[model samples]
Target: MPKIVRHGTRVGGDALSIRIVAPPERRASRGSVFVPPLIGGSGMQQVGYFRELNRRGYRLVTFDYRGHGKSGGRFFVRNTIEDARAVLEELRGEFAGEPLFGVADCFGCIPLLCAAAERPEAFRALALFNPIPSLQHVAGPREVLANYFLPRDGSGARRLALRNPFDLRGMLYATNQRLFPGVDKSRDHFGILRYTRARTWLATWEYLSSRPLAGVVSAVPALVCFGRSDRLLGLEDPAAEERYRALWLRHLPRCEVRVLADVDHYWTGTQARASVAAADFFERGGAVANALPGSTLAPRARYRDPGEAPGRKNQLGGWSRSSGLKRASGR
Candidate 1:
């Protein structure tokens, strides 16, 4: 087992907890930093996947945002972009001359993109999973208003009951679901409400709704992956993948898009597949620069089980196919 090192970095008076996994042998020529999702998401949860990448001869680094996991200070949506920038700067210094890659999940993609935009030369490539291109596409007015009205600080239960009584019942139901063992264990529904200050949640909603992705260009090779069955992000819509693909292409001109079969918002049972795909992309140098963006809804060869016949429906109800990466037709 490779020794896992824990460290801390100061970012504007906040102490961010970071973990680094080094390869078992000599230092690696490549390194990747992972940016975790907001709310209940923590870098600690990704240690297993990072260890796998480390075993593949790549240095892996992941950290928790302030006020989340082992980090110190209150969580603020606006501070996330700087947090990402600081971490990336550290990685660039440590991995000098080595190709650096980035991987972000869900809302985490927002800050990563922003930081990458500010320093496009810092990364050779990027991979985003279940990215939220825009909050308007996923949230409704009622959800926005509820978060906006929440009190800044207090007992979460009492605050919801007092400030937004209408939402209290739904909050109770979600809390029950979170507390019930083995019930929707793959998802996080109440973490923001239960753990964060309500003001932070509202700020996050506002920041995302403002279309922060607009006009932000990173110009780095990027691979964007989405789950075909992502109910949380409503990716089940046949056109949703294309919509996100188009948005990412606008920011990352050299981009690739793939839809994973049976994957969910949290990746769930298909995490290994996702990890392998990401590792392969990084290994390939994130696709040659200047190549037109490739798009495919078909599963990669590694995604298929050995001896699985082509055209047969897998357990996920998606057909298995053998194919190499190819340019998606019709734009």
Candidate 2:
């Protein structure tokens, strides 16, 4: 069995719950940090992946997004990035010598990309499953509007006045199941409907749609995998892969882009494959990058502050690795 340790970090006034799982040792020979997708904070969503990675001897760290699962503070797009920086800081202190890898799913890709863009050297490689560059690209305007009721710090009364009555994400899930047989609608899920704050939804839509995909680039090797039949991103069409290939090539030309035939947007039964792909990418190193024919590794560059981009500096609160965090729990 793997040893589990829990940590809490006060980030921008919010307390984040993070879990670190490692083989029975102080440290592992290799490790990677897992950034949960939107609605991905619960350990229930990630424990399987953790166990699978553990079998490969990789230490794993996963955290609950604020307002989701047991973490404190309201969830929002900017907060996601802030929380991610805090997690990375903690990872540095706990697992120093080994190369760190980053793995994320769906909307989690936004913050992962933002964090990686801001600190390219922080991760040795990155793998994004069913990545969404912008929610606006996938969701309808009505759904986007449903998330813009009140300000981040609005009074409860004010927030209630503007609250959305419709379960937009739930409707999306229903529609997805109808469109694709692969979506496992049978299993119950604690989806975004329960923890999604209006401010968080609005902020995510804005951040994702506004940010340039090129800025999400990294000097390290990158792998982007999505289901060929993903209804959310419309990758089912044969032309979709080529479209994404063209888009990703513009920013990260050397990144390996794979379109899995049987996978779906939710990754319902495909968790094992995703875990294995991540391990292969991190373990094989240059071999994985080399395997993507017709692409040469990009030149390594010093960490450039991605915040220098227009309107990005203050978009997410400043990042700090300062040490005032308390060990909320451990085992």
Candidate 3:
């Protein structure tokens, strides 16, 4: 595989660092782009995603945002969007073929959506997983039932952050130690990512109340994946669901929403399924305005439930693990 190139540039009064993993051998066709999570700096290089993607004809690009990894400025609202613009500008300058769309997880969605809003033409598609959505909505609920179910007490936001001081760190010291043991953090990551509890709380709040998402993006193809189990508990109330519906209806009416069973927020046990959905959306040439279902735009021609196949192991006949092209079955 070709080695990833490291470089730094100044953007919006901040110094940013990024690692661009070029294909070892150039391909005749353009490959998909992979944008990683900002919370965990275990970027493409460290995750071995670059290597796998390299062989698969993808040119994986990973970068450290100003605050999270090895970049210069302090992390704050709007900066994520600015950083994304910087990366896209750089990639646009270097890559020749079609602009690549990407996949982002958790808080990563804030910047991705922000960037998409700014330059929908620059991307081919987007697949977001368990996004932070509206930080304000996630942090605090507006309804009595929502407040009752998704309490912001000790067990909610504060509890998760307090569980580990470095829980929100981009460097991922804990994930490295816990998952890979003797993993390399410095060579693979950059920046002081140990976000303080206060910073975490404030950042989440800001992400929710940040700039508008509707006018920013056009009718670009998008896929949203959220684990069935990771339901934003705040939406327990029907009214809350309406609020969410309004949010998406406003910004991404063309996007397809997929809820994977047994998949946690991280899709830990079902990464394969999430991966398939993402790749399949792109391979199927993506859609606009409820073409693939799950949209509020169309309901009658919606996709069928998996079990409706009567009884079969490969009910969906989705892309097989062997040939990652896509699940062979269709809606």
Candidate 4:
């Protein structure tokens, strides 16, 4: 069942709209939140993912950010945290039983990390995938807007033709801070961009700091997965993998981390396989499940029986240790 709700109190000041998928027969009472990508408010890319998660008997909630989708707002940088909080409040209000799980993608996870550090009551478990906190991609606001709204058309020319990085970015920084969200291409998320630029600098600034996520410590279980290939790292200096590992290890000791293979910064070929792994990981009560084939949809990673472990198939075609992910990872 998909239901819509007014996420705000005002009549016309601006209301957030949320779409939820209720569990089938078990009558799920717990809810999981999936934060959409920068410009993907309609969540069309996630429908298939939601369908699969619904089968797991979990109530899943997704919403258009302040400006990106059905919600009211204009585009802008820095409003990420506020929107995440608003969504969390709605879920907490609707569900009285079951755990609150959060799954954040790409730039969407920053605010949640900020919230976990500042407002811990918001949610419980979290699954963050390839969340890059630094806005080091550019220095100006116009560039920020373009990067947020531009489609990854897979065209070098299209990407470069979209905007002039140096000049536009300078213009953005020179513009007034109170009303810049309007510059972002997405009309729906513009309002939030406008409001957040005016008040959400604290989290952004802290995230840019040397310690960055130092303040965050999730009491609830957390899963942080990074694609093996991300353009974020420039060679040696600070390998992206090591940086993330160090950050989470220090701030979130209970966190579990995984490096997805055969993928790059964009997660090109491994999306389905990765999502399946993630869904299984979450549904399995936070246990670390090994990946299957290039993918596996098994609820709990039972792998093969001891006898059928990877190497020896014995007489029967049943169990084998050489066949499972744990054996490969030596887990």
Candidate 5:
């Protein structure tokens, strides 16, 4: 096993905790950065996928977002973009001539996309797992209930006690979801609550929902993976699946996509399979250059205006005046 070096850096007023797993013998020719999920910790790299990359000759860099782990600061939705950009910029200087790649999961994908939009040349490619394109893409009764009861901040407990008074549905759902078979148990629940704040959670949700992904366009080669069994992403619903593929394709035209069987939002039973696919994709130059042996590109779809409905937000969060591709120049 390669040794991991611990370090800290300041991004704006916040201190970020970062970890780097250097390739054995320092023979690395490529570098990869990991962007953790909303409730993720730096410990996520222990999942073995990152180690696999290290063994395969790719230097691995993973970090806890400000306010999330050993890092010091309050978490906010918008600052995450700056956080990602700062990390990438630092790595670009360190890696120098080597190609740098990005791997993000869940909410992390949002910041990764925004960062890549700003510095398209900084990344050779990107790999996203079960990315949340919009709250509408993952919102459902279960999700609403989960967020209501377990707000990222600890105040959810107090608010639930005062607002609903007697209803324990949120609490019940939060508890039972973890006990479900195949849920990944490695994550630290207590640590996540200690750092997360309710104000930041709400702000993050509002920011993501209000501004659709249409405005952020990057020509960066990308590999997007979805879990067929991911209830949070509503992949069980054909309409939801189609809508997600269409949204991703619009922003990243040079991309390859996959829907893996038996995988869940947390990558439950299929972490190895997902990890292998990502590592292989990265090794093969991270571009779609024709469909890899087993994978197939999603069928092309026509883009349409996101017209509003009478009662609820459209899948793309209704049409925004800023809802269109603003491709990066000189890519």
Candidate 6:
């Protein structure tokens, strides 16, 4: 066990909370900050992961965004990013001059990418799990329902959903369970949904759907892991998977993208397995040269015209390995 400290801090006038876990004295110099998914709180849901990370030689910091459990203000995309930056600033002060790594899962990837782009030198490397490449990736029935349920409009439906968040809660919970049945449900994860306000719908949708990841490219290394069977992000299909792989390669050519076979969006039973991938990536300094023993490199993909679908037949010929990108999977 390690010393765990909790505190409430103000980021851009919004009160946010964080839990800091100190690593063992021998590995105190190494630190990794984990940015959790949309379900925010006192960081209890991911306590298991961060604690394991700490045991693996990394000091850990996890936080809750505004409007989430133990945090003040509304949950908005921009506010969450600011919350993350504030938490990072706090951690940097504690581990001054130490090498830093970032681990973001689900929606956490957005702000992590934004933070990396804003302060390229802040982190030495970043490990992203099931990253939402863009809001468009998650846009669908949920997005539509969220927009229809926006509290700003003061609609009857909005009032109902807020009055009984369980309806929306079940929808989200079932979605997760379907995607990753092996997820540990021992923690009280209902807080993320319970505290969510109707106003968050509009803000979340706007940021997720419109925010462009292309502009955030940097020299900093990123280890991107995607579950091959992810339904939420729909990387299961070969074509869809290739498109996103090409997208990331186009933006961050040096990035190492590993596709975990049979895994889903939430990582479910793959936590320990994924952690190994992250540990290896961090140890290799984000280079593919030292990728997991079975990992291999593929050529970088170039961005095609927006009007042209990725891998669509063209004058150059149909989709092929020579077309710039190929699927690469590893543990």
Encode model 4's per-residue lDDT on 62-157: one tens digit a residue: 655555445665443444566666666666777755566666655556666766656556556677766655554313445455553452355523
TM-score pick, better of 3 and 4: 3
Model 4 segments beyond 4 Å from truth? 1-13, 24-30, 34-36, 39-51, 119-122, 137-166, 169-214, 232-238, 287-331
TM-score preference between candidates 3 and 6, better one: 6
For model 6, the stretches where C-alpha displacement exceeds 4 angstroms are 25-28, 34-37, 40-42, 141-190, 195-201, 204-209, 212-214, 290-331
* Alpha-carbon local distance difference test for all models: 0.59, 0.56, 0.52, 0.46, 0.57, 0.58
lDDT of 1 by residue, 140-208 (tens): 555545444543344554244344445533443333332222221222233322233325346545645
Per-residue lDDT over 1-331 for candidate 6, one digit per residue giving the tens place of the 0 to 100 score = 5766775578777777777767777674455655554543335444444345666787667776676656777766666678877877777777778888877777777777777777778888888877886655765556545543443333434432443443544444443333333332222243343334425356445544566465777566888887665666765456888887777666655688876665655454456666667777787777755454255223322222222211112111111121111221111
Question: How should the candidates be ordered by lDDT, best one leading?
Answer: 1, 6, 5, 2, 3, 4
TM-scores of all candidate predictions against the true structure = 0.71, 0.68, 0.63, 0.59, 0.71, 0.70
Residue-level lDDT of model 3, residues 1-331, one tens digit each, is 3656776668977787777766666564346474744443424322232133344455666666556546777766566667777887777777756658776766667677777777777778887766665444333423322333333555445222224333343323333232222222332332234453126566645644665353654466888765444443233344754565456546665777754445544343345555566666766666643443343231122222212311112211121121111222221
CA displacement after TM-score superposition, residue 102 of candidate 5 (Å): 0.8
- Residue-level lDDT for 329 in candidate 3: 26
Question: Model 3, which residues run further than 4 Å from truth?
Answer: 23-29, 32-36, 40-42, 45-55, 141-192, 195-215, 231-246, 288-331
Candidate 4 TM-score, C-alpha based = 0.59
Worst 10 residues of 1 by lDDT: 316-325
Summing lDDT over every window of 10 consecutive residues in candidate 2, give the lowest-scoring window: 315-324
Q: How many backbone clashes does candidate 1 have?
A: 0
Consecutive 10-residue window with the lowest summed lDDT within model 6: 314-323
